[model samples]
Target: MESSAQLVIFAGLAIGLIYGAVGLLSGFCLMSSMRGWLAEGDGRLVRTYALAVAVAIAASQILAGGGTVDLGKSIYLQPTFSAPVLFLGGLLFGYGMVLSNGCGSRALVLLGRGNLRSFVVVIVLGIAAQMTLKGLIAPARIALVQVSQATANSNSLPSLLATLGLGETVSRTLAAAAIVVALMLFAFAHAGFRRSPGQIAAGIIVGLLVAGGWFVTGYLGADDFNPVPVTSLTFIAPIADALQYAMLSTGLTPNFGIATVAGVFAGSLTTALASGRFKLEGYSSPRHMLRSGSGAALMGIGGVMAFGCSIGQGLTGLSTLALASFVAVAGILLGTAAGLRGALRVQPLAVA
Candidate 1:
């Protein structure tokens, strides 16, 4: 209805388009990256992910520092959060990712490429996420959060530093710089990774997309009459919301998330067609379908509890340097490790 909201939606579309194209071309999925690095002994993809995180932090903090956006308004910076719930959610989501062989965003990309199995995953995940967010599971999720939640005066790392005598700007800059430097080092340490320009570009573009989403909602969409929600690129809630909006278009107005989700699908489809890579694919067996469906359910439920998916918490949430984000991410990493290694590891499915 509002002009600014329209602008935000259009901006979201553009960001999603770029992200879809880049993701399709670069194979940028956290599960794939982790599998490559840990399971396959290839570190280039993981390094690309690390670089993206580093760049996202740098770019997002710059926007905040310039007063272009209020990071405080984002969900990651809430004054009260349940660390235990978030961590558990992250674990569930991570393990689900491994079971499903990818996360929500990855499933979207695959769907764009005509993967019918991803279609199943997307549908199941959306329904499950919606259930967790506002349907039957909402009560349990709410009860758990209420029981485990904790409140704090400083909800973010920079804000925490601010209370320790540093100026607001200084604290933000210091924290961002320290984290960025460490991530960059990890991203660039490998010679193979350093030599790959395509992966490098993918990281940079994806990171900028995260910041771009923030700018679209926080700055461009800021209106005195009807302000858009201050958010960045994340997949879990958006996927559920998208599915709802698709069915209830007569009553619901599209938001940035829904538009972005559509854009990702469209963008990926265009890319796949153009690249001659589109192919219809399906599950190899009934067991594969069962595993995939189960995994999607976990992702939907866990993502809701954690307040984000892998790309959501791993990149966008981390950009805010929120303490809860760190806890969630740690849980995600641990969960992924469990799935990728040890006796609990998910074994590869045999082709039917």
Candidate 2:
């Protein structure tokens, strides 16, 4: 049994490394997709992002139907719900992403491209994430969690459909098919978008990566004696945890997410160096530094409040079809829009 568990852990590490490598290489980013669509009139990235979400939903639901993993075990689709936190957190995170000129995932990708600004954003985001997750701000997070008073049983749409008299298998299949078809249709509807092979492949691979994380942690990492936390790619808390782990690795066993985070930076650095993209850069002005720092802090607090960052709740949590994830995604979209053009607009500044 111990050997079997070790095998599973190895499998998870491999999967996470692959995900990190692919994400760093391809520049797959939800924040960028939405921002491109809204700000630049380039719909390809957003369409690709939507397709990835659809793929994640379909693949994850199929896994659940096959009894390969239990989606309900993850936190995003908790039995209890928190509408306020999800929406509010999304709002803050969305604006922060724009203010910082990228989302958490984007920050990682840019960090790989040898952008010092992204490094700063990520460090601040990680620390703020720690504060909300288990640091000084944890009490406030717990208090907010307590106040929301929302509830749900299953995380997927199938679970909700099951309560309406649909059989589990049938509900899961139908729900998954619907989302998948809608996303595909949306993606292919645009002639320009369909022509972008890089974006399309990025969408598919990244979506698979999200589902892969689920399979690794939920299925492979399951152990009776030494259980692993059910999680997928989420940058905010993981970054914070990664920072802490660096200081206390002796006391902490490495987990799937941490390994993946490390792999992304290493993978990106290697790619950058090999491609001659490596360069040391810093903020050109104190104002720029301040904006980046505050944006990172907002992302940390908001990501914790909402329970996941773009990759975490948006992709991983969505894979489970959790209602909370859906709500949170909606909030992220709204927040991103607000940051871009809403009353509380956060203008994008150039990274130096």
Give the Cα-based TM-score of candidate 1 against the true structure.
0.99
- Candidate 2: residue 231 Cα off by (Å): 2.0
Candidate 2's residue-wise lDDT over 315-342, tens digit each? 8878887788888878887888888776
Query: What lDDT would each prediction earn against the true structure?
Result: 0.94, 0.79
Candidate 1's displacement at residue 346, Å, is 0.4
lDDT of 1 at 231: 97
Residue-level lDDT of model 1, residues 137-207, one tens digit each, is 99999999999998988888999999989999999999999999999999999999999999999999999
In candidate 1, stretches whose alpha carbon ends up further than 4 angstroms from where it belongs are none
Alpha-carbon TM-score of each model against the true structure: 0.99, 0.93
